[model samples]
Target: MTLNRRNFLGAGAAVAASLSAPMVLGAGKPRVVVIGGGAGGATAARYIAKGSKGAIDVTLVEPSRTYYTCFFSNLYIGGFRELSSIAHSYGKLASDYGINVVHDWAIGIDRDAKTVSLAGGAKLPYDRLVLSPGIDFVDGAVPGWDVSSQNKMPHAYKAGSQTELLKAQVEAMPEGGTFAMVAPPNPFRCPPGPYERVSMIAHVLKEKNPTAKIIVADPKPKFSKMGLFQEGWANHYDGMIDWIGQDFGGDVVEVNADEMTVSIDGEVTKVDACNVIPAMKAGKICEMASITEGNWAPVIGHTMQSRIDENIHVLGDACAQGDMPKSGFSANSQAKVAAMAIRGALTGSKVFPAKFSNTCWSLIDTDDGVKVGATYEATDEKIAKVDGFISQTGESGDLRKQTFEESVGWYAGITSDMFG
Candidate 1:
């Protein structure tokens, strides 16, 4: 399925249904506890509540009151968008859908008891638990770098204050200074995210400090939309970006946050700004619940249920579902599937075959955008990709502009779908 504005809107509409008669399992309504109020959790909560029509009780646990989307944070870094533009609230999900929105950190999970322990000393009991807590950086994945050094070398991957800090650091760079980026390896959140950040940083530097240089040391030999990003870099910001992949010792890297320096291939270079995106793992809650297999929770594609425990469903970047990249669109797609399954299980609603789709859009410069996406279906083993498409190199300017516009529309539509 080609994912356009019409299809996006149609998908959102499809998730909406009339009230269904729910099975009375106990004294109260079927309870669903969803952790992480980002794309997957928010969408799942909204879909379940809307589809069930008071049949299911949904409680969403998230730490932040204002959720900043990682999808468009790069554009905020490039000054194309304001900081407020990416920030979202759970107001709609609560006011419109009647979801019990709890602002707190989920510290522990007792899978045997089907309860989640919050940092505020509250316990949430659930008939079904949805874990969509997103990614957490692997400790020691990047040598000499950790959360403590985030002020000096901001990861900005979580898209909040770190994003503001990184943008401030970039704008504060001295003339002719170097900006360094340590990109993470594969199976991380948003495959094209780090590269898109580079483009946004380059875009900023080209306008403010033209002589400033950008260096990216990536452990991966190749990245998503490589050809398109390379072409855009050459066309828009020539001689401003240097990308060193694994072949060039980019894999052998370390950082000295105190010295504001990076060591790639044993060569040290001082940098004014550094964005250290370390290797990622499933959010800590998955491990706490003992559902993780080597950093991620394995899930059945048909229902997004944890392989270890069927009562728990894992979505988004935390799950090891096959084929789909770790992206907001992928998570949103998975959430609907999980929502349908949960509704079916709890309310005896009709269940349909699972279908998924994702489209990742990247902005190279003003009005210059590209995208890659695919359609997927749930097989017995995995969420297998059916077909895919990408923006070709040397595309016409009009098409690129159209693609960027399409992405803007998607952001609006998806946010509405998730939060409402």
Candidate 2:
């Protein structure tokens, strides 16, 4: 599906090529520029590239040469999966799917010009733009955890860079040291992520240093996959995890970096390592495009199109689509819906109602895991959940295991659809 640089005839030059070769030539294909080649952006590019069959010019803009997924990042701490194992490249998306992959950062979006400005001073114009740049940090949300002091205690939410930073801190810890985790407030990416991360680190501690301990300062009393996670921690992990719920002085009021002390309810505590999962907001690109509301972008749930501007689409963690958690699986699923909607909007074809799904898997022990899932249908006012899509509280052992396997299958299917 690829064409070489020398053969990339200008947009106006396409008429001659189309006149010579009717079936295989692209004359006036609608241009689509996607920012952020993570799960949502990559999936959107692949789907649009293949579905349009040379009828759409697709260009993906991302700064990273390779993407390390947030999924299974805990495995890195547990010594199960290396950072390289989860790193994804966009070569296939460019070569196999006919997408023009630009390794650059998108600095600004010119809504009036219908173009994206790159840091290299290049401007890419598009008939339609699909933005899926994911989330970014909101400064001052957590005092003392902003740009500078984060070097001392890193929030590994974005994966890649943060993953390495957190890993180094853990590796350099003194023997039998204490590791403290400060989880974000509700409705953050991967609801059970911090808990699972601590679990994995605890797993490493149990094996390497028995005297080591893990402290959890959770903002919420209950978490995703709560029952299974607590049971596993108590039964198999020797109850090594010390959890302080929101009511029990677990809410972090402030942090002093030099002292390495976190104040919870004005009570200070010291730690050998600290992981503070800060609050999140939509990527700044969305805000630049004037599509975000508060922490996320408001999109028509049925089409994944922006409520403010119909020509632009937003998905993944950046979007505030209801009933679906900010997750990789959800992003991949929404990409297909957004792709179809964009294709239809371009070709004057039928646009079907969108259906969204997401399931997050958390591995408690080496052999045990749990999951939570949901499906939703969009309405005029908002997206509503379809019945029977969440993890059951009273399900049996075999049922939970089935759900665990389902998450693996989903990751495979979604990535295949994205880069295959």
Candidate 3:
């Protein structure tokens, strides 16, 4: 299915009523606690509250009061958007939907007791818990780089101050200086994100520092939309990007934040600005809950329920669900499925088969856009891809513009769906 604003919203709407389980009996309204306020959590919180019609008590625990979306932060870096444009508030979710939006870090989870411990010294009890805490870097994933070094070699993957810092560093680079990127391995959040960042940075340097160069050391030999991104780089910023893939020692890399240098295959190069996106794992809270298998939490695609614990559902970049890319659209899609299941489990609302879809849009340069996406269905085994689409290499300029326009509309629609 082609993912537009209309279909995207329609896809999430509940379908024909099916038999529901007996309504969960509890002392008060069945409590639902959602951790993390990104694409998945926010959407799940809103959907549950709205569909339950106050039958469920929903409390969302997120550390930040203002959430900055990772989806369009690249455009912000490229000057296509302002920083404020990507920042969102939970006020609407609180006021309109009546979700208890708690601005506190989720420090621990007691699955046996069905409670979430917050850093602010509060214990939130839940009948069902939604964990959508997004991704966290694996310790020692990149040699010589750690969270402590983030200030010097900003990962900027979290999309807030780090993003701003990386942009400032790029703007502060000397004329003809070199910018380097240590791209993450596969199964990371947003498969095309690193390449898009490269494009956005290239867009910035093309205007301010035309002579500036970019070097990307990628662990993978190829990436999502590789052909299209390569085409765009050649057309818009030719001779400006040097991509070193695994065959070319891109996998054998290390960084020295103190020295501001990158070492690939024993060859060291001083860099004026460096963006190091490391290997990722499920957010720490998943591990704390003891639900992770290796780096991610495994889930049943039908309900997004944890394989280890049925009462807990994992969503977004944190889950080891099959086929779907870890993206904002993917998370939002999964959230609707999870929300519907939760509603059925808690309030005896009619449930339907889980249908998921995702579209990832990348802006190559001004008015030059490309995308790839697919529709998915939950099977007994995993979430399997049904069909998919991608932008053609030689497509007309007008179609590319249309694709970009579609992405802009999606951004507006999804955010509203999430926060409101």
Candidate 4:
């Protein structure tokens, strides 16, 4: 039988149970502080509070009141989903699970005293800290691109207003105009995100302005799900997209936001809209906490505990876990493992072996969907991939449509899991 949303969720029940086992606290309640309210942080916060049954005090620090997921924002750009559909509120996490939701910036970390300093002049003490702060762009990763220039050439990588801005820019483009994208380097958040964004942009253009063209200047030789994306692009929107790899001088690129032009290996081309997805590093809070070794924080595979500091566990795109792509699904899976281990350490709950899984689905046209996924197990050294699968080229249209529907179900399920 074909996989549908209902059965898929039923199958996940056992997995969820293994990760979230309630604990009975003995005496002094342990305090857990979670920074960042995105995929990993929010899930970690929810599991800890729900599993501990008020035995552990869970406080979540996030700057944004409404969290816009970066996962399906591309679908919004393609006119497949509403902006309100992808935006989530923290009220559910607070009211339903009794998590202490603090909407403030975490400015400093006092590791010696085990306290986190807030921008509002309050210090939160944590017995165990879970940091899932996500990603921040590296300075000068793309020359002539910076935070100040984001308004002119929106990255739209973080979702929210940036996503809105990018969509508006694409819609306002003149007929037969150019949409240029500067893809990021390796080990970035959402391995297939940039290509998916390209597909969405192409979808929009195919409807609004058929003559428009997409130019992708990628730094890497190949990208995630390359064969599927290329095949879909050919079959769905042929001759509308041009993907330039590193061998063709796509690696070395410079942009002039003021001039509305990009220089790729000394060749210049003017564009109506541009998206510069710069290289990413662990969020600044990780650096502030002194947990980051280089661009990412190193964590033990079984528990996601920071190698730099045992009391702190890093999750999601910010962590340097082996073989896991920096997708929201990976973060959410890792969050469950960390939550289980934290409960075990603090409340003396039973700790189970870490098992993780992730599936990334991208829509080419309306029902033309492609995916890649894997199941993983934690070894002593790294999170190792045990089994994997990908959508084969030239699959039946019915399978692709089912895959698309499955993705829709997954979005609903995972968002509910994370926010609630």
List TM-score per model, in order: 0.94, 0.90, 0.94, 0.93
Tell me the tens digit of each residue's lDDT in model 1 across 180-287: 999999889999999889999999999999999999999999999999999999999999999999999999999999999999999999999999999999999999
Clash pairs, model 4 backbone: none
Task: State candidate 2's TM-score.
Answer: 0.90
Better of 2 and 4 by TM-score: 4
- List all candidate RMSDs to the true structure: 8.1, 4.4, 8.1, 9.4
The number of residue pairs in model 1 that clash at the backbone is 0
On a 0 to 100 scale, what is the lDDT of residue 13 in model 1?
A: 38
Tens-digit lDDT string for candidate 2 (128-246)? 89999988888876776776777788888888888888877877778888788778876788887887887788777887777877878777877777776777788657767888888
Of models 1 and 2, which has the larger lDDT? 1
What is candidate 4's CA lDDT for residue 225? 98
Candidate 3 residue pairs that clash: none
Please give the TM-score that candidate 3 achieves against the real structure.
0.94
Worst 10 residues of 3 by lDDT: 16-25
Worst ten in a row by lDDT for model 1: 18-27
lDDT, candidate 3, 1-420, per-residue tens: 123222333544342122132321223367899999999999999999999988888999999988999999999999999999999999999999999999999999998878899988999888799999999999998899999999999999998999999999999999999999999998899999999999999999999999999999999999999999999999999999999999999999999999999999999999999999999999999999999999999999999999999999999999999999999999999999999999998778999999999999999998898999999999988999999999999889999999999889999999999998
Q: How well is each residue in 1-420 modelled by candidate 4, as lDDT tens digits?
A: 232222334566554455434321122357899999999999999999999888888999999999999999999999999999999999988999999999999999998778899999999988899999999999999999999999999999999999999999999999999999999999899999999999999999999999999999999999999999999999888999999999999998999999999999899999999999999999999999899989999999999999999999999999998999999999999999999999999878999999999999998889988899999999888899999999999999999999999999999999989998
